[model samples]
Target: MGTMGMQGPQPLPGISHVIAVGSGKGGVGKTTVAVNLAVALGKLGYRVGLIDADIYGPNVPTMLGVTRQPNITDNSMMEPILSHGVKFISVGLISPGDKPMVMRGPMLHQIIRQFLQQVLWGELDFLIVDLPPGTGDVVISLVQTVPLTGAVVVSTGSSVALQDARKALEMFHQVKVEVIGLVENMSQMVLPDGTVLDVFGAGGTERTAAQFGLEFLGSVDLNPSVREGGDRGMPAALAGPESNLGKPFFEIAHRVVSRAIEISRSESDVLEIS
Candidate 1:
């Protein structure tokens, strides 16, 4: 697939699509959405890879239940660890054991570059990048180092969260990266008696997406199973799309695929015209 030509960095060889998942602020379950989306895509029989780009917060390894560091190949390239059928790499794996990552912009850029170029990702239909919350140096480094196929902004349905989500969308715009859509995480809660509650406010994310002219991919309810799965390093998406908890993720995965294809086509058309 042809990558969008806005950024100078060319697409990595052997990777078809590079999708970044980000949020305006923290505590919005951005990494959770990224991990589950990757797993769901894998469940759909696609070769998927996940990158824990959240440098300081490197939670992808914990969420996917992978604790070991990546193996170094003969060529010195790092081999991503496999878990839940998805190949992944994270700083958490490299610098494990709760030691904080204290570094400046140059160090951040170097690590991000290493993760992108020094990894033996092999062939992948989709490479989901779990970006750190908020618009920061890490995001700038990523865009400068990769031609993203697109990005998915994650947000809750609260006004404060949506405000930050707007900044995330605008950040993508400034970098000329196409936003595939917005995924509303923790949209609501369902009580045992079948009553639905708008704990975070209803439809705010969808409304924000519409305001920004972006696709509202779908929403994942604030369910205990989702939390349990994350804590156990077993994403709820492992339950397959047939389960209530897994269905929304699969739906978002499908939408992401469609959006990616559309972006590829549009980019191809632009290239041909040029």
Candidate 2:
């Protein structure tokens, strides 16, 4: 721990696939997707790590059900908490809910750098970074610290989100980061009669992807499982691989794995990090 009781970085890494999952704005379910995506990839038997990059609103710890403070060594490195079979760390664990991140840009950058370089994330296959809504200091620090494997943008089927989603992609472009694709979250609602109601609307993610020349990962239904599983600290992909919501997320996981989208290593160098 630092002199001010601030959590520092993890130990040096033997990890791959540091992904940045982001949203143009909040309420787009970026955290939900990030948590479940890590869990889904873990199901493939990969050693996964989830870093709650949302310094302002640290929700990944809650979604991952990590409540314990990270352990610190005399060397000032943090040992991430283990939960849901995945190694994890979050600023939320260090700060109470009442305290928001009001530090200057340098402090924020330092905190992000600590998480990336100093943490002891031993031999992880994938480190899914759940960035805060919108492009800001956190995202800048993350991408600036290390070259990311790719970035996954989460958006809804609304023009408002769509507009900001474009800006989000532009942020990635400005940073020279790869845009993996767009995920259409809360795609629809499954009626009791087994019909699909496009509540948030349909094809918004697809349209956005088409315009940006990025692929459309898939659509996530507004299943209660996403909510319940998140609250229970189990990703929906674990509970409902057969459910409507699960199908899309699982498929997205497949896409991420199949194409070798992230990770700079060769096939021989690639081992399931989990």
Candidate 3:
């Protein structure tokens, strides 16, 4: 995808693809999807990194079970913490505990830029940014800071969630970022006795994706094990791709990699023509 901002987006050195995982509104399990996606990509043997850009509610460290602060290199760059085979950095690392980050727009922009440029991420096949929900300052700051390969929007199957999800898609479109696809999280719940229940109503997210002409990556069930795993700081994706809990994330990761490659190739073609 083409870069944003007047000065244009700067590419991160040694990073092949940078993907942002976002949603229009909160409470849709966006961070869960992002964390699992990064872990799944790593499980698939790709080097991965994750950035918890949700400044106000930096839940990635909790979900990843990381509480250690990053080490500062001799050159002053923060070294990302390694967890579950993926290197990552989050505001939670710097300021741990229940205290909130009370800051203004300029401070938020500076923090985002620092996370993008000041971290020694080394080489990564994919750097997944878990953005705060909504079409707000963090999203704008991200695009202005670095060139994104594409974005993956997460939403539940609820119609109300889809309304905000549409807004997120529109925001990405307006910013000239290629939306890689839409992933429907907590789409359904499998009850005992071989029955399926539509917890948030069925097929709404996929329908929304079709309406926007974007790929419907896949659906994830609302399993209690998934919740328990997240709470226990072990993502369900650690079960590996062949397991039931991890298969969906692996499937989504596969589609995401494919879409990113397509976007990169298309951008190359545009560059050639220009």
Q: Model 3 lDDT vs. the true structure?
A: 0.91
Candidate 1 accuracy as TM-score: 0.96
**Per-residue lDDT tens digits of candidate 2, residues 160-179?**
99888899999999987778
Candidate 1: C-alpha RMSD after superposition: 3.0
lDDT of 1 by residue, 67-120 (tens): 997899888899999999999999888789889878889988998889999999
- Candidate 3 segments exceeding 4 Å error: 1-6
Local accuracy by lDDT, each model: 0.92, 0.80, 0.91
Q: Which is superior by lDDT, 1 or 2? A: 1
Q: Judged by lDDT, which candidate is best?
A: 1
Off by over 4 Å in 1: 1-7
TM-score of 2: 0.88
Tens-digit lDDT track of model 3 for 81-193: 99999899998887788999787999889988999899999999999999989988888898888999999999998989999999999999989889999999998998888
Please provide TM-scores, in order, for all candidate models, with all chains considered together.
Answer: 0.96, 0.88, 0.96
Ten residues in a row with the worst lDDT in model 2?
Answer: 259-268
RMSD to the true structure for each prediction, in A, is 3.0, 6.2, 2.5
Give per-residue lDDT, candidate 1, residue 175: 90
- Candidate 1, after superposition: displacement of residue 114 in Å? 0.9
Off by over 4 Å in 2: 1-13, 243-245, 262-274
